[model samples]
Target chain A: MPSSATSNTNGHATSHTKALAKPTVNQTPNAWSFFAVPRPIKRIFDRFPLLTYPANRLPERVQRVKSADGHALFIWCAPEDASENRASFNPACLRWQAFLKSQNLQFHTVSSSNHASTNERLPFLVVNPSCSSPFKSNIVSAHELAKWAVDQKDSWPVELELHYEPYMSLLNNEIRRAWQYHMYLSPNFEAFTAPSYIHSQTNSSVVRITSSWELQKAAREDLMKSSPRIDVEGLYASADRAFFALDNLLKRKRRMVADVSAPSLLEATLFSYLFLLLELPLDRWLDNRLPEIARKYPELVELENTLKKQYGLQPPAIYDALTGTKDSTLNSRTRLEKHFGIR
Target chain B: MTSRLNLKIWPSGDGFPFPSLNVDCLAAIAYFQLLWRTTDNAVNWTIISDWDASQSPNGQFPVLSCSCEKEIAGILNIFQHVGSCDSINGHSDLNSWMNEDELADCTAWSSHVLTLGTQLLDLYLFITYENYYSTTRPAYTAFLPLYANYTIPPAHQKAAEKRTEHLGLATILGEIDDEPRMQPISLRTGGVDPSASASASFTEKIGFGNRKEILSKAQKRMRLESIVARFLEPLEELLGKKRYFLSNKSPSSLDALVLAYLSLILEVKVPDRWAAEIVENSKLTDWIKREAPHIYGNAPNKG
Candidate 1:
């Protein structure tokens, strides 16, 4: 029996241990060690494989599956249609899916909402054991997922890497501000993004409204990090400047190179932002700005189309449903088919 | 009928008995000690340094569990609870020094100290990586098992980061997510030594990858200094040459609160000396020393 002193009110033994034991600054405990079997325990299991009933039951080369619900890599991403072709409507989730696709990694995507994730953020990846290893099964979300990808040797080229930080900052800061303003701060947040994304997740209208409010507040706070207050026109102008620089870079690269089929990490980052920005059903004033900006630079549109074709991503059907031009139910079914690769 | 009152606080380091590394824990202790000194209530307090805050009423430390099965968490709430019970009687009414206007002044100052003062302390102790890893975190994790020493500090640090973020200071300091990888000598340096001449030359060597990082860090440092200055201005002005804040005769709960923070700030050896410098430059250190015997039995000669 486990020690009673180790039992926390939350019923999590780990927390109880955390409360009892003091942490030192010397060494951070290996996260993998938490899942590693002790030498003695491993010996006991090795001596009698039958006694290790679960271990004996696991299929060959699928060692990680039995440890935690049987999978090499389990991704909790936003709901996608049947063929799993169209990227997630959530920009963050779409970014992860695109990143994974770019890396040519095979993984299972579990359709989940933000609430399902450990950090209440979507596009979390759970890495399971492929074979016996000291590293435990790890669940990485947000930027940590990107870090994990880098650890796996899926990194940008040196030229792209040099520009990666500033570009990422640009995306996370300026481009993100514009995208968030369009999605949440703008009028379309309530009419489109909130209802389709946030409202569908929860039953309570209060939660939907409050969650939207909170998200918008967070976006505003993020914007305010650079400046004391929000400047709508200034934000759009800064966003336009960022787009122009990116457009010029892509245009120059396209013109200079004979065959530039390989997508840069910069392109992936830009596509993540633009894909969401272009596909979302925003109010006319907010919606027209991005397309107008994109129309000025054919390179951006070409890149978007290339990414869409590469990923087999379909046009988001939520737009037609929101506009009341098509039956939402039928649109959703077709989307599901397209996403899941159904007949 | 006398009710039993049990005060649970985070344990102090071996040498530092009454003065806990945590400002909140120290404040809670100071509040309780003030109650004991002025009131007829018999309080039995336990120093449970490894106490699980999640088990408390408010998911924080310094919980006051009364015989009535009422568990009050947070220093202010516990103080209010004790006051409302009429446990603090006779000379214990420190508020008697203030007239209506003075009382309002006292309360305003108290609120300011609680909010801005606490934020300043949070920045000094937790938000800054050096102070956190070196002093605050080690003190809390000192008595715990080896495994726990690794897990608990990060958890507490994460919470502190969140608290600072909510207060909007995290933006100026850069998000916790953006904190540099913990360097072995980081705690030793105490978060970019203000006096270090090396930082000037170091910026040149930052390379292309970390150019943005270096710039933001400098920006954060400047903003933090301004914020610290802002928090100090009111306190410095209010306590100018006064025997105690808002009262000439005796120390009030406001005094206790301020002293709790001041004493902790003065005592802890952190990288940012702004708070310590403020305490040294003002009469607050003298006041803390003067009130030390009443709070800690005997005033500690050294921090």
Candidate 2:
């Protein structure tokens, strides 16, 4: 609980007094505000739901529909997408969406761009927004979404998290670099990633081109942090090796979507990366070796195949693309995944 | 093959300090040493401890410049280059004999060490307040020129800051810094401050009265344990009863990677040695004692 000073009074009213008290040289309150910050300046106070933000209004609201549902998850969804049945095309949002589904939480994924999130990244959950007063913070960052999910549940997949951190390094380093390299830096960017992330959000040619350049530049700068230049071959080789290692580990899973009790958070992450690698048109580039490497593992493909239906994650077009009229059954079981492992 | 292979890295400090203070550079040297052991020194590689890292492709140290191939930077790239050259004579790449499963396990564990293991080492050597300032900072003076030493050590520390920002360890590191400074009222000064203590009860003046301080101290211990445990526990579980990580007969790339980080933590004498203490008591201690000397080669100058 907050101390009495904070608890006893309305936070906003008390906050103005605190802000006024901050400087030693007391002057007129209106004197020295920066010309740039844009009026009514938001402030965070030491009270429950500390952040105070300006509400999104007018023209922006027309394109982006705000769900009044307290459990609405704002994600890196397409700007027009509203259906709960469709999966989030973006991997970052889909990870959380998959996790929430596994936890049996009924959240409607909101169609949002990166700017919709509190931290200006996608996949932030709006927690009880209806009860929140105007301009009061109600959004939970993607970083804190897992904590929120865990807090709500009585039973958790504790055993699956046994050695998650080390396994996490596999996903964070090798697989992540490969994914970034393919999506942003490779020829696949123009064919697939640009359509999904960049073109879908904007229309002006200048915005599309510059945003594409800026996004790829950011990925390049991050890649260059660990090396002198992007070693494309090295990255693909690492991802291949990572896939094989994950395949070795994935042999333990009988099914997906928390698997009756396994809630590793690693599962959600693996699913997101594997789903995109297997399902998306990332192989548009000649060097797009990730999809092939991802397919070599049967367990990985199986995990994505089962988890999609378990979570209702097939986003219509992808569902059609995946189950293309080749409805052939295996020795006994009928396969939902028709495109993968066809080497 | 006749001409010497020049591998440049950051030089060792005097009097048995590491061959390189940096983990990647250290691992790079250990990698070559392993290659020489298995290949009967066919590669003719020389470890040149040069301060100038500007010449390399990556603009970083631990670069391999050979007469036959283009100079490559980074440990893995260098390993790749050497692996490419393995077919010459009877020289075979390390782990070339292993089946697909073993090779995959080796790569996975090595990746683990390079990622999470690097973070843990950074937390210990560079990120912590007391250890960097008191010990690791001054130790750099012996290896680097005066101006470069000041610039380079801090660059490592700053990079460590960026690397570890995601781990949520800053608060615990802050508490750990305040541990020594949180002396009792009587102990901090020659005795209790008379003016300050006058308002307090008898128990408050003598010290041990601050429940908040005691509580934070306990909390700090648990947080520190948990933070280090997240990195080390899986490693401990993996290393149990095996002579090497996932192997018994011969050391692979994973062994070299783990040993590179392990030797530094055990050897580098830092004032706040909590991390080192944990490693000393871990499952890998015997493995370290036996393998470190053989791989690093006791004489830093000999390589």
Candidate 3:
């Protein structure tokens, strides 16, 4: 019963709809109908198969599950550039899809073939850039499929959900903690670190469990909990996917290759390394550098337990020391030369 | 001389602006002070050449008096005081061979002061004289008032002006000076004939005596190669084998100072570039987060 309003900012008066009188859910209205589809999504549709793509064609590819009322989200993902085979699979898209799949609901992925991609889908979330969708930029941008959900909000049956994942460097640990401390201060949405980061410390294999009922059961049993493994997969997969996509995109265009120098590659590499480092568990790092930290940061102990349970780990060597072991006898230059083929 | 000095430093408690925060001198001072503190050595710490003299008592001691004779006198006075101090050993010369005790205890204070003070003085002189052709006149104006307050008033004032002008010319030559300046329009005032009063006065006022000879002598006196060799020897020794400066402890001010000087000097076009770089290049930047992580609101990477 949710009503929609045409954006007055653009002086467009025709598309106004009233709020849902018989509200089924507490959902925010879509404001992105006015803007163009995000650049990446547009590229996807433009490269859509000439014939209709089967709703369930890529079964393994589609990971999100349907909600209790049979509502599942969809996001359109495409290469940042045309003529590139690699798609920048956003981490959020993968997480959301995984969450949905765990719910065990029947859903459809309207791929590059779908022409009716709009933001009217109810309970259907869009992870588009904040401009073109109700969802904020932070979460969705890193996850193109999330952005697509926002871009195609009008096609779903339920309320639209928008999410924003901030750039990683923007939030330091304490600030991020403070943000989590007062998440409810904002009425519309919530924020979370990557699932892979939450799961990074443990060695558990997280098989997606579907259904709200099942999710609750798992939550009660502490079967699937916060661990760095999930975060490593989520964050690293997204960055790596994006990196490959960018790499593929750049390789195709002579202009970008000619213009982008060695520094840009190094910049990208640094970003990748920093993200990997940040995703690592502080407890493991602390154990190597200062054992006193385990006593000092109590949250780390709790986090360590959660990670151990999630990853099904029974205490392994800390990550840094594992890497540090290789460089013990051999110098860094030699190691880099041996492993990375760089001197 | 007054017996006991009670110093009230501005922006005090840990991070004070003395001896140029981005330079090696502060680190040397920190080490010396740390050593002095541990040993319970009694040293007279005074306010000298503070950027803001008005912040000090009577607004005189902190000023770097400009008169050539006065500056030279000031230099001599410090040496004389150090010589008189019971802490300093007066007998030893660099040319003589030294025993372990003599090296460690005999001239600890004087030798330390001499080595550190010489570096600072050389840096100051480099910024003031040889590099003056690239410096601006306004920045040097701070020393004017200090020069005016010296024992020999006019002489000190003139020396201050000379140093300022010398520095100004060096700055105009576009070298070590990094102070922001007004952008004047480019005009071909066409080459001024030397006979013209303006050109003649400009030459007479700005020119230094026997420039090449002075530079060669200064270079020899300072032993640039030796200092650079020593300065880089530690780093070179650790290169490719170790990461971060100082093999053991978390980065200290000394690390930042050395790194800042090298980084900043390499990128002189950026005003305060060298100073800022010293803070940026190594683990020093992250040390700020490590020591006081809450201030920046981030946990340091132990990895």
Highest TM-score against the true fold, candidate: 2
Estimate every model's Cα lDDT from 0 to 1.
0.60, 0.69, 0.29
**Between 1 and 3, whose lDDT is larger?**
1
Once superposed on the true structure, which residue ranges of model 1 sit more than 4 Å away at CA?
Answer: A1-83, A128-134, A151-158, A255-259, A280-287, A323-343, B1-303
**Candidate 3: regions farther than 4 A off:** A1-343, B1-32, B39-44, B48-84, B87-139, B146-230, B233-303
Identify the superior model by TM-score, candidate 1 or candidate 2: 2
RMSD of each candidate relative to the true structure = 24.1, 11.2, 27.6
In the range B167-239, model 2's lDDT, one tens digit per residue, is 7776566345445443236545677566555554466667756767779767766766776676567777887
- Give lDDT tens digits, candidate 1, residues A1-343: 4566455333554433443343322134532234344456556655765643344554543343435432233333334442355566666777777777776665555556666567677667767555325665467777686676677764653333223344454565557767777777776665456655665556676786788888788877665443334556555654665576567666656666656666666677788777766654434333457555655667677788788778776544455444443445455445544433434
Among the numbered candidates, top DockQ falls to: 2
Q: Summarize candidate 3's per-residue lDDT along A1-343 as a digit string, tens digits.
A: 1233334543332222212122222234542244434546556655763587567643442333321123324432321211221111222232343323323333333222122234322123432232333544322222254335434443322110110011121122212222222211221011111111222222233432123234234332221121111121222222322223223322333243353222221222222222222334443231222122122433333333433333222211122222444434234234323332222
Q: Give the per-residue lDDT of model 2 (tens digit) for A196-216.
A: 677666667789889999999
Residue-level lDDT of model 3, residues B159-180, one tens digit each, is 3344334223334222423342
Determine which window of 10 residues in candidate 1 chain B has minimal summed lDDT.
B85-94
Could you say which candidate leads in lDDT? 2
lDDT for residue A192 in candidate 1, whole number 0-100 = 51
